[model samples]
Target: MHKHLLPLALLTVALAACQPQSQNAAPADSGKPESATAAQPSQADRAFADLSKRWLEGWLQLNPINATQVGDHRFDSEVDDLSAAGRQKALDFNKKLIAELDAIDAKQLSRENQVDALILRNQLQGDIWSTETLQSWAWDPQIYSGLAGGAIYNLMAREFAPIPERLKSATVRMGKIPELFAQMRENLDPARVPKIHAETVAKQNNGLRELIDQFITSNADKLSGDDRKKLDDAVAALRKAVAEQQTWLDKTLVPNAKGDFRIGAANYDQKLKFSLNSALSRTEIRQRAEAEMKRVREEMYGIAQTVLKDKPTAPEMPAQPTPEQQQKAIEAALELAYQEHPKRDQVVDFAKETLAQATAFTREKNLVTVPNDPVKIILMPEFQRGFSVAYCDSPGPLDKGLDTYYAISPIPDDWSDEQVESFLREYNNRMIHLLSIHEAMPGHYLEGAHSAQFPSTLRAVLRSGLFAEGWAVYTEKMMTDAGYLNGDPLFKLVQLKFYLRTISNAILDQGVHVDGWTREQAMELMTKQAFQQEREAAGKWVRAQLSSTQLPTYFVGVQEHFDTRKAVEAKLGDKFNLKAYNDKVLSYGAPPVRFVRQLMLDQPIE
Candidate 1:
């Protein structure tokens, strides 16, 4: 969901430093028989190790862009062949691997090996589902646009090789852009294309020119004459291809687009299982979300009363305010928080200051082990806009020592004054502090660093989105519990507001995709119930339409983490320590929450 592509198979070697000690017993003392020291690997372990190596090699060869992104330069000059043949080849390969993996006897494996087998099998199954069932190549134009932009962006964004060397690879990739678009046009059925997908791809295709101008041409001085000429020719060809794609989108795709964006109930259910990697069903998720929404709202009402106690129009503190009173009280208290937001241009600066403070607080409280890797705050690239306001772009596990980017999007010039105001209020000062906590410090930046230290390259590359998001959400409560802002009820109030946002995201995702809720219904849930501003609500409606299943990960993941913590605390009682628990949970890399629980509790992995 984060869109940072890497070949999961290619990551085994990078994980060598982070691998756990083998659970198998050591050889007996010298007094024991010589056969004890000559123990051979079990059949399952031998099969797993051999299969993992072969599968990774095959996968990397098929996905060269992923290889490049993950710091493997073997395929640096190659672009993905997005033809029908390419798709079929990939599908066949996955099926073969799945069959091979299935043939192994899991009961014969070590507990750790068994867990890895499960993780790898699920990953393969999910890939098969996407290609065979979901088939985004048939409807999603954004797929091609992403590939084109990423081909050039990945080379320019990192310094894995010399400028000349990377530029040469970029030139080779750029030459393939026209063919890539041609493949996309041939593969996509206009009748199946979503209007939103078409429009977004058109905008993104046009933005490629900006990526060239800003990143490529701006660095022309570093190139030799031959390399510069190659780049110039590639840019000209790429622009023409992008323009043609845009024309096809506006004139052909948009007019004839009859696709429904929703995947409907059956597809949604299957996808949810793979996406979550959790035991909970859709019905269970909805029930839990609805109950939590009510409980969180009640908790927020109490905080709202406390924050608005002295305000002239504040409601009296009742055991339970009527729904109307609760809304009014929350709006008034939020106004106090929103009054301190940064000016439009200062948001990035404010984020920088907030990160520093968050780092200090995390260290002072010993919340978790903060990584020493540097993080930078930068503007979001033009090609990657139109999504969330900010994201943490950490380096691939294979690309060690590089800086992690915390890219924030600036307010668009086309936005009206009212829209701008709405945006700022939603990301008010206190909320920005919470965002930094989630994206940096003890959030993605820190957790990502720890995950990279995992010795299983397979696990490192196949990091779970649910676990990553869940950990960030968990940290918000962790920081709040540690008395952030000297235990300010106002800070807690804003934290609850964010908690409400996550709850609403899960509801809104399911409501629109599964139940066919209209935009107006979604706006009501976000603005009225979650306290999101108008601009924020509108943007989220677009995001929910663009993606499915991902929105629920935050809620489901955090619940698992919370449950895991509670179980550990109950077991340890007075012996429990926060830092130790945090370190141990993160040490497993970003596996499914269930796997993390098994490893933490020494239970047999299912």
Candidate 2:
């Protein structure tokens, strides 16, 4: 649900590295056996490969800063021109790429490459279908504006370009912000901004203001006198423009906002086709989610029954508190949680220590493969806008030697005590341990580092969100299965609670956008399913509305991974060593777990 995963952002980030600018793919790896290609590839295989390369290159051009960060220098000096014409050009490119990919005789590629080609084609085809069918610009203002802020900040954060080049580009892009905002202002239909979205933007505007201030303060020393003067003037103008825009949003945008976040059945069907990359339709996802939810809930209740069996059964268990008292208890619990938040300097240290602990624990027990590359955990930048609390930014395969950034956002300073308390309770210490395991050791950082060592650029560029999030979620349970919680019921409760969140997200995402559910419905589900307190549920409800298709990946993905592991164990029998299996599993980039199974276990890619 992080807007940072927007297609352009994904493309930029996906191939972020120093790679070729030409549409030609990287020459096939030098040292692999000819058997890797499965005899001579057919015309369709060659066509898919060629189209995939061009599609990736075009995408990189569209998301330059991401390319730079991934070690691709092709677009270091350029920000995307998100003009209408530019978007049209991108659409055309995707359409063409899809056509070329579709023309290929898919079965002719090697089994592994055929799977790659199919997904590659699907991605390009989906890109075209989404842009055209959804008319995303009608609802999301973000599409109107190029993500200059994120792209620039990420490049600077990652140290992708030379500081001087980046600084200069930042200054240049700073001059462009007013125009972009102005254009966005003109292009945005007041009626198209949903009231909730307007409110979200208003909250986000404050962050943008802080971001502008932070940029000047942090980078002041890098500016020359003349350049500083120019940047200062630009910053002042942008601040004034933003202030004006905030007024416009409050007075005009919010008041007149009439946009529907839900696309309903027709559009939801289209989005399912595009976003899901599956034959699964909205109704199907919903049914699957409902069935999955019922199964998971029953399982949890079973766990509960076992845990609580010893207590004497009265007519009913005594009620603990009134609703208001329960709310107060939740608030009090949150306060206790915030007290555990590490001091700022402890951020990196905590990550390093946590990573070491997680790795040592996993490796000592040989629970899973731990990659060798050292991951550098950095403070998440304030300029990057939020949805989720933490994320992993891995170096691209093309940029193999560069460090991985496990960015964890420190709590913002200006948040009210209540907000801080609520957030902390939402992400308490036990939750942090789950998150650390997911983002650092055997989760994304470890998996991503291993993927960078993969020989295939194609695989890296086409990494699956499902695989990434699924692996992280799978690890939460895997850790518990390996006795990470020891005998603590509370720790285990938190883990189930986290998985419940994934389940809740799956339900709520489809519920809100596809089924026309209201905010209240979402909150009710989150509160019940995830045991989330009101504030956290409310936040997630809004997030569910703003983003589409992203929420389901965690649960769906993790389940796929868990299922795949079970199958792998059955196949390997006595040969299955947890470490070796995991090592083999991750050596390929983050492909769909199904495809991963096919590759690792030599199953057909059905």
- The TM-scores, one per candidate, come to 0.94, 0.84
Q: Model 1: clashing residue pairs?
A: 11-457, 12-457, 15-455, 18-454, 18-455, 19-455
Q: Tens digit of lDDT per residue, candidate 1, span 405-458?
A: 888988999998989888999899999999999888788888888876665566
lDDT of 2 by residue, 1-606 (tens): 112334542221252222222221333331212456556766665666666667667777875655555555545556665567766888888777766766677667667677677667667766666666665654566543325455445446555445666666666666666665665666567777677766666556545566666655477667788877876776777678778767876887778879887767676665555454543455665677677766655444434434444545311212344444433333333233345654443555665676777788888778766666656766666545445667777755555355667777776677777876666666666667777888877787777766655555666666677777778888878887788746455566567667778888878887887778977788878876557766578768777877777777776778778778899999989988877777877766676677887777787775
State in Å the error of residue 397, model 1.
1.8
Model 1 spans > 4 angstroms off? 1-41
Q: Which runs in model 2 stand beyond 4 Å of their true positions?
A: 1-4, 8-43, 144-146, 206-209, 212-217, 223-248, 279-284, 295-353, 372-379, 383-386, 410-420
Give candidate 1's whole-model lDDT.
0.79
